[model samples]
Target: MEVPAERVEPKVEAAYRALGERVSLPGFRKGRVPRALLEQRFRGQVREDVIRALIPESYLEALRETHLEPLGDPRVEEVSFAEGEPLRYRAVVDVKPPLAVKDYSGVPVSRKEVTVTDEEVEALLQQLRERAAEYVPMEGWPALKEDLVILDYQGT
Candidate 1:
């Protein structure tokens, strides 16, 4: 992928500005460091920051142009850049393979017959009956195992 110089320059400038804001030096106040000095001190970090910001956006744009969806993160390689020149990089990625239906006839499909016994049917019905069972308040005893305890409360 190639990102135009116009795109690359702005990001580089922004990176310098951001770095200048946080970096402190002996002669320069924070955010007032000279761009050339910042470049001298932090060239690699600034380039890396710009690349990190630009690559994803430019990569997605390139993918959209080619209508390709990558299966995973790209292995970015062979990145080259210069001032007043476009940023160039090679991204190795896996895309979905093309699919074609060669033949639909004689696909050799088989269906197995399913059978349910009367006992199974009776058991299913019993489960449904149990699920639908209702209990009314009974005069009497405290809750026991397997019994549902319901409570009533009033608050002011």
Candidate 2:
């Protein structure tokens, strides 16, 4: 993405102005730093801001222009930036491959008949009987710790 001077110069100027609005220097109130002073004191910061703003914007523009849905974040490289001039850069990125799908209608699925053993059935029945049983009062006997439960069941 090689942004021409016309585009980058304005962004650099805009970054300077935006920085001016937020910075406070000695002997001056906030947002009152002269452009020359800001350029002298924060040139590196201004360039960093310009680069940060330009890269993502240009990357998105490239993606839109190519109509590409890439897979990962762009790795930006090969920058050529100078004051009062254009921004030259390159980006490396990964993209998704075309997917291949096959064998829809003819796919075979296996079926099996479920079988339960007599022992399994009897164990399940015993569990059910214990769950359904309830305590009843004995009319003439004292309730003891050892007692037999008789469940009269008519199971479906």
Candidate 3:
């Protein structure tokens, strides 16, 4: 799909201007810098802005012209620019193929019944007990899992 020549120019310019507003130089305030200064000071930044702006506009135009519905983001292949020239780029987009969708209504779907085992219940109870347990220093012996160590409880 191809973007119209007329629309491409304005979108590129708008992008350029937007980028220019974002770029700052030694002598200019924010959003007040001239395009030439912006171009000189932030060439790479401006080019990126142009790409960001042109791609969307181009994509939209292509979609409208070709009546193609795309699935994902388009892959940009090439982009190039020069002073006074229209921004140009190539993109590969994955478009939805023209096809008849099959009827999905009343399609059978299977669901499994879930059952909790005793072990699972015991594990859950053990976790709750651990959460409620408080650590206490053992006087002479190492602690064991089943040992219910006494603890001083406090709440705020």
Candidate 4:
């Protein structure tokens, strides 16, 4: 993806201006620092801010231009930026591959006969009996772990 000089210049200028407003240096008032001084002192920061702003926007614009819908977040590979040059960057993206379908009249498939054994039937009946069991309150016995409990309470 390449962003033109016209688009890159404004964002770089804006980043410098925003940084100058908040940074105070010796002999210069806030927001009164020269662009040259800001560039000298904070060029890396300005570049970082501009790139953070431009990369995602440029990636999306590139996708729209080429009509490519990526499957996941892009891995940005290389980035090159200069003061007056177009921003050039490369990103690796994942996309679905094309599918080619063939004839599907009679695909070979195999089947196996299913049978239930006596032990399996007995296990199923035991599970059903357990599920059908009902709870009955024991009036005189103390409740233990795994017992269904019923509590009566009043709240004010």
Candidates sorted by lDDT, descending order?
4, 1, 2, 3
* CA error at residue 147 for candidate 3, angstroms: 31
Which 10 residues in a row give candidate 2 its minimum summed lDDT? 142-151
Q: TM-score for model 1?
A: 0.74
List runs of model 2 lying over 4 Å from the truth. Answer: 98-156
lDDT of 3 by residue, 1-156 (tens): 344456556755676688767766788888888877766767777557666766787778778988989899888876766545666778787889889989988899999999999999999999998899986767889768888677689999
Against the true structure, whose lDDT is highest? 4
Instruction: RMSD for all candidates, in order, please.
Output: 6.2, 11.4, 8.5, 6.8
- For model 4 the local lDDT of residue 55 reads 95
Q: Order the candidates by TM-score, highest first.
A: 1, 4, 2, 3
lDDT of 4 by residue, 1-156 (tens): 789999999999899989989998999998899989999989999998999999999998888888887899999878999989998999998987777999987998789999999999999998998899899979989888968889999999
- Error of model 1, residue 103, in angstroms: 4.6
For model 2, residues 1-156, the per-residue Cα lDDT tens digits are 788888899999999999999999998899999999999999999899999999899889989998888999988899889887789998989887777998688988889999999999999999998888876767677656656645478988
Worst 10 residues of 3 by lDDT: 1-10
Clashing pairs in 3: none
Candidate 3 global lDDT: 0.74
Worst 10 residues of 1 by lDDT: 138-147
TM-score of each: 0.74, 0.62, 0.48, 0.67
**Tens digits of per-residue lDDT for model 1, 1-156:** 899999999999888888999999998888888989999989999888888898999999999999987899999999998767899999999998878989879789899999999999999999998899898776588888867778889999
